[model samples]
Target chain A: MKGSSPLVRPGAPGRAGGPDTTRQAGHRATGTGSRRAARSERLAPYVLVAPAVLIILGLRLYPLILGVNFSFTGDGDRNGMVVGLDNYLELADDPLFRTALGNVGLLVLLLPVAVAIPGLLATFIYLRVPGHRVFRSVYFFPAVLSPVIVGSIFNLMLAFDGPLNTVLGTIGIGPVDWLGDPGVTMFTVVGVHVWATFGMALVVFLAGFSTLDSSLLDAAQMDGASLARTIWHVVIPSLSRTIAFVLVTTMIGMLTSMFGLLYVMTSGGPEGSTYLPEYYIWIQQGQMNRPALASAASTVLFLIMLVVGLAQVGLLRRAGRQD
Target chain B: MKQRTLWSAVLVAGLTVSGCGSATRTAPSPAGSGTSSKLVVWDWKSGDATAASYIEKAKADFAKKHPDVTVEFVAQPFDQYYTLLGTAIQSSTGPDVMLFNGGGQLRDRVDALLPIDEYVAEDRQRLAGWDAFSKDGKVYAAPVTLQGHPIYYNKEVYEKAGLDPAKPPATWDELMTDCAAVKKAGKSCFALGNKEGFGIQFFLSGLGSGVLTPQEYDDWIAGKRDWTSPHVKQIFTLWKDVNDKGYNNPGANSTAMFNDSWAIFQSGKAANVIGLMSDIGHWKDFGEFLPPDKIGVMPAPVVTDGATPSLAYDGGIGYGVAKWTKDPKLAADLVRSLTSTEALTAFYAKAGAIASDTTIDASQSGPAAGAIVSAIKGGKPALHVALSSKTLDLMGRVSQKLLSGSLTVDKAMDQMAAADKAS
Candidate 1:
């Protein structure tokens, strides 16, 4: 989305303040009689921005520093002691923490699948596939439910003797241990997380579609472009910015917000294969009473999010520009 | 309550002054207990419907002695109770009195609790689980209820399998044969749930008495455990073997013990379940689904010759005075009232808690209760309770691995031993 200019847009045509008109106004406003007015006007933007700047510093930046500081300390008998890097050392030694990091890597690899599911659905809806109106509402219904509710409902449906398996068994397929198998649990949890969150991304795509050039679609149809070719040549290039935004937010959501699903669905168990950094931090801080170690995990998780997110946005931007 | 608080303040103050206090910073309030007269109590049970009458009775008991003091009970969700308490302790701002589970859970945080030994001295003979609430000979909490794992069999299931419910199996081989019969009858032998890895804990402790010899049982609790011992290894082997043999309900790994596993046994989907003796998941609970007569207590079948089967029990839930309390004596008095004979009797009657007060009558509940009550006299501490929180957590994960075939019993035992040693 592009930022809107209510008052001044520098190079746009027929705006209230043209560049030539602004120069004449600036000369009159800075004259001897209006010097005080000009000075205060110069300070207005900073005045408008002060509250948000202060809030971000206090709530956001301060906590990050506090957490990083805590990560260096010790827990339990050594509470409040500066046993530098001891907590981080212990975090490294923990197999569960390693599993959490591995899970993060897995999520990164699966990021495109998560993005594509909603992207493809929105595309179909935009093209007005049969029952598209009903499909749009129905497909997005699960996303309205909280992750806790989604996880619980899935708990029943994905059980060994659950409905999903019962359906599979009719065709002699399986009674898969969906949440218990180490190999399957992570995917199951990620799938549920996406199931419960895809609607938000779908809404974003729909809004992007509203701004899409419909004439291009008609022109493509007038030519001989296939549906796949049309999407690749026309739709993809036009919606690149929205896709980039969705990718960053979805990756962030997967890394930080899957804690609830992991907690409710598996408790990071079935051999801790479903462990994510957020869940691991919770176990360390909450269950194990090792606040320092939890802080260390939190720091690592934050770094992981930062590095992955920035790289993704930059890559997306370069891709968008090239297109 | 005021007078007792003054006495306790002086006593604890003297200890701190002499530099022998367990926690020195939580000094008595200078304005006295008057400023902090509103005594807040935190627990996970007060919100539970079954425990409502019990909390009310305890509150009434406390009110009689200190009507001037206001008592506020905060019911915390059980899953997040410890984490919330940990946060409060870190901030040095929390309830005056709080509930604690016994053994490693209490032992781990005993430093944050005021020793109520002197305050609770009068009730020593009445309560039986002091060891669980005590650390290094100093009692930090007063026991309110006893929790134990007791193997409960469905008499109807046994009868349907053509085995006389009156004459249940008494040995491992007999149990296996009976399980085969039950299996053939289209019901799993056990309704096991290991979702939280708690099923394995229940399995180990419930059957441990019949797996370990008398000397081995006592030795394990005394910090002389031999995890590599064949008998110890057998417990894990049975855990793996039973699941492998299809003796448990399907999806045991995903099924929760609190309700799902119990539901199977309640609906007669399984023959037996290693159930608890207090709170939820007990005889009282199972009785609600199946007729009380159908729910029968059975000691674990003898796994090895000379292995004595006994009930595995310990202090279930207890109330402790927080170090930050304005009135340790007042909080301790509340603990005493919570565990008082009259209060506990109401608790046992209404909530089906095996009240810490032994004087509370148990016969009225039923035959299963009678058997459990009789067995309590000979019961030993549960095998799992001896484990530290860290070790128990490791065991939970490894036990899951064992079930999933990723890990072997011997390797699991080695990991458990390593965690135990680190603890």
Candidate 2:
């Protein structure tokens, strides 16, 4: 009936059509509206990401760039003229820098073993072992105390006339100078570092364990899998992500957090045996008036962290793929 | 999503705004007019009870003199003092006057200090030891206090150890013999805590002055003289001798100077303390421990066999007006007033400090002050102030190593030579 009504008018050769033109205009309007909507949709994710990107650029990237630039320049005195890689070259030959790097390397190598003990404890607790709650809390208590307090307390405990020596005397063992001897100083510092930090790692491990699939565990148990086998094949693999996170973060913390302990306990002495990179940096910048050297050392540290981080990311991605 | 975007924008804006605000706040600005009502002073040591009284008196006196001005005193703790001073000076929020120790540390910060030579020139005769204030021919700090480290012993402990209480050691050999007697008496001979490594300096400097000529000492400091030479070896040997003889506290290597040594000496478990200006008052309860008459003060024993050269360690504390101070003239005036004889005498009497002014009558000093004055006048260098901080810190570590038996005299001397060369 509508077609019959419209059929009365036929257009001349050059005249414009009505219904067809109307349909085309409607399509154009709808296309423009959809394009606007699509543009906003594309922008929404970027708008969400912009603040984070800006923050990273400001706090991390900018300081890193500035540090790198300052490292190549002369010491920040009135005569702080740019000297182009002199500081880095000096760092290459610097004995103190070598010592600092060696100490930091030692810390990194020792940290994983140190952290594993706490990780095992957490795993035990996560499996609902007897008295798990009390054990977990007991293990995690150290993490709540500040490093300075821990260091001071340890200083008193390990002092020459303190309880440690008294215990040794009673055991018919000779007195040992825990902090004074070069051989024992690093071990002392590392022991304190592990004690102060292991709790946080345990907490992370527990959190990771809670997310594991109980169904998989039960299935493994039904198949007559042993406890060790279930942990090895099921639990550890599930918590690989968390383990990587803790490993990198703890390594960074160990490199930096020794300052408070060293300052409180040794002041980097009994012959600079406990001097780490951060403490060395403090001496350079604050005590020695050698900020250029400190900056150079800082640059080396940045590079080390960068390499370690990249390696960690690569390993984690490969592990993720395997999973 | 729109609400999230708005909130995120607000957060970013907040951070940026705060950052800008702090940046602006931290930047330096020019001084206000002289007619300003308030004056600020920063001091670390002078905030102690005795020093506070003197400061209060000075404030009252200054206020009475200048009715238009109000004085404010801020005492920063020793640990945070330098940091706050550095930041404040850099930002021009510094006090009109600041207390400083005259040493290499002060020399390093010489650029931050305002030269007071002009003020001193106007009141030249009023100053004492004018050279103490000068750095690079410009007086930047005004001397306030003189310090010295003397060996103080418990006379009863000496008598108990079969050494004469009235006659302290006159030579290094005699001192060693006395130390042995004290040790044999089942008492700690000396309170030598190397944790802070300050005790090491006192020992080294005392020995070094006796053994090395002034020229030789200068050459050694300048790295021109070999630290592996006989003089250096002798100094370390003396240290080793003392350590090996059980003269020092048994656990000296691990003992903290501030915490452990004070307790040891106060408890009369130790015979002697090579104590600074502060240690005299530490024995305020002298009657309970040793009786007032039993506390004997003498020069740190000399190494030279004959009459002991009047050897002592003199450390000076002073005031410097920050370069960034808004009121330079007022700061200079404050420094002048603080260093004046009238001000210093009162400060010394009140604070138990040895007067830095050589012109001041030593007879006028209290018993403790008299000892410090005599020590300084007799030609002693405050080894802590004489050597650079790095050198001092190295000495500290080496001394610890020496006590621990990890570093022999030969090895320590070699290390010192190497360190001196490096520095």
Candidate 3:
């Protein structure tokens, strides 16, 4: 194995230099000076990443550690105290925490539907259809608005005497209780969430579509591939990375970004139907005066993100290996 | 040497900025030289506008008297006012005298407020219900207005439903019967939107106090009694009964207090509304749906066989002196001025709310204000504000669950007990 290493070293010099004196010079340089070069080269990756590493450690990791430490305590009265794992133990019996978990699961299941509709909508715009820019701008307008603004607008629109009911009246359809009914409140919030976020997903898919080689699409068309077939077989495979990226981001956004909408719209009510874990954490901290419970809830949220992120990283790594 | 020069230049720049800040410390008032150091007074009531004009008059009057004190009046939107005040007071940079919501939350921040015992003692009888403004016998706030939540009904709806327009419901059964009739006549009878839950508490507690004694209420608040008791269960059952009877708007659970359900009542789609004293000024516009003679006011209903009917009473806003204010006496003067009968009378004229002072007779108030005062004075006891914070949250949650069919009265009561225990 030691003798064969010399042959492997020759491949690098042979590729870089012509097979004469240049090759000898390359070999000489590698044999003599490569050790020092390799040491710096190995450290170069870490040197480039140092700032980001420090930032993550300082901002993200430190807070996460502090939150976990707080979660173990029964510090509901004071800001914090050390009780040692009692908070996590309490979670086993916490009905609200369980409800929050179930709601988060529901949110996760609905996220793909939320992401896909916008993804396809953007794909249509990317195909250069008539009034595509106008369509894109209109579809993306809600994304530009703050969640509070969007929520308030939806609250007005869904109100009993709102314009929506007026339109329903014109159609001779009875009014649907969009926000009042517990069963429908989640769906209404989900609708608002999709409206508010789908634009960013659309734009991402459009960018992904733009990066695809047009010749491959042309080849697929020459082979009599239908649009659906082209999308499923070629386009989707080419955009798998983008799809993965959008999926992870959409999940994270849904888990964390619904607080403003929940606050302004239903306030997680008509019986906590629209209550997500994030809003629950806020309620625990602000209303319940249970910062320890909130910290525990936050720790659970952190674990969820960590698991989901690690899984995504693993999947991406496998995909890369396959490629 | 170059590094030292660079450091010296940076130091000089910092010194220049700091020097400029110090130079402006003694700057004259922007309003003018005659204008004294501006004393800001913050409040959230619409009456603030009338109060502003009153303050302008007071400023001229006070200037003629003192000639050195200047007052600047600042009013903020009601929703943002408390948060802005809280933050400002915490930072030691709030208005000299500002309005605070009178309740436990303000009581929690006692350290941030200056005790107004001296101010109260100077004119004790002029300040009505001084006990309510006192914390441990030391007054921290001066009450400005008395907000009584009265049940106002559209007389046209009553007449259309074949009920007497002159005689409004005085008992729970009468109210329910009239409501059923109103609903049958193709209009929502009562506008009870519990989506915010505060409105629910207002309605329930208003009626509940008539049935549940003050002792029972105290027992509930103190965790000695469960909500499943007949008295407490009646409140929840009444909510369910009203909802089941379709007396309320169909979308009330989703409707916000100020936005949908209340707006419906205002538009005459709903016949009856529980309105605040402040809402009396808007009655003229609300009465456009019904003739002025067809609108009538009454206290919130009492249960059958109950001794007294009750209305929810929110002690409107109170003026407080910030603890860190440079001029406590000036702040106290501002508070005293705002709460004075002259200023309050002008406020009452504009807003149609009763002045807090008992010396300002109800007979002198407008018809609407008199009605509000009568309803409040007739009330048994306001149950909602009397409950502890923990019990209030329990009530809000249990009421929500009961309405949604997720909790029965017994289960809700148990949950309330559990919540009390947990707290």
Q: Number of the top candidate by lDDT?
A: 1
- In order, what DockQ does each candidate have? 0.29, 0.23, 0.23
lDDT per residue for candidate 1 within B173-257, as digits (tens), equals: 9999999999999999999988888998999999999999999999998899999999999999999999999898988888877
lDDT of 2 by residue, A193-309 (tens): 888888999989988888888899999999999988988899888888888778877876786577889999988777777777777767887787777777777767766766877
Greater-TM-score candidate between 2 and 3: 2
Pairs that clash in candidate 2 = none
Ranking by lDDT: 1, 2, 3
State the displacement of the C-alpha of residue A269, model 1, in Å, after optimal TM-score superposition.
2.0
Q: How many clashes in each structure?
A: 0, 0, 0
**Candidate 1's error at A42, in angstroms?**
6.2
Q: Clashing residue pairs in candidate 3, if any? A: none
**Could you give the C-alpha RMSD of every candidate to the true structure, in order shown?**
8.2, 8.8, 9.2
Candidate 1, residues A1-323, lDDT tens digits: the string is 02323232332234323433655667654354344444455555566667877766755676668778988888878888999987888888999889889888999899999999999999999999999999899888987788889888998899887899999999999789998888988899999999899998999999999999999999999998999999999998899888887888788778767877887899888888888887787777667778788878878877776788679879788867865
TM-score attained by model 1: 0.86
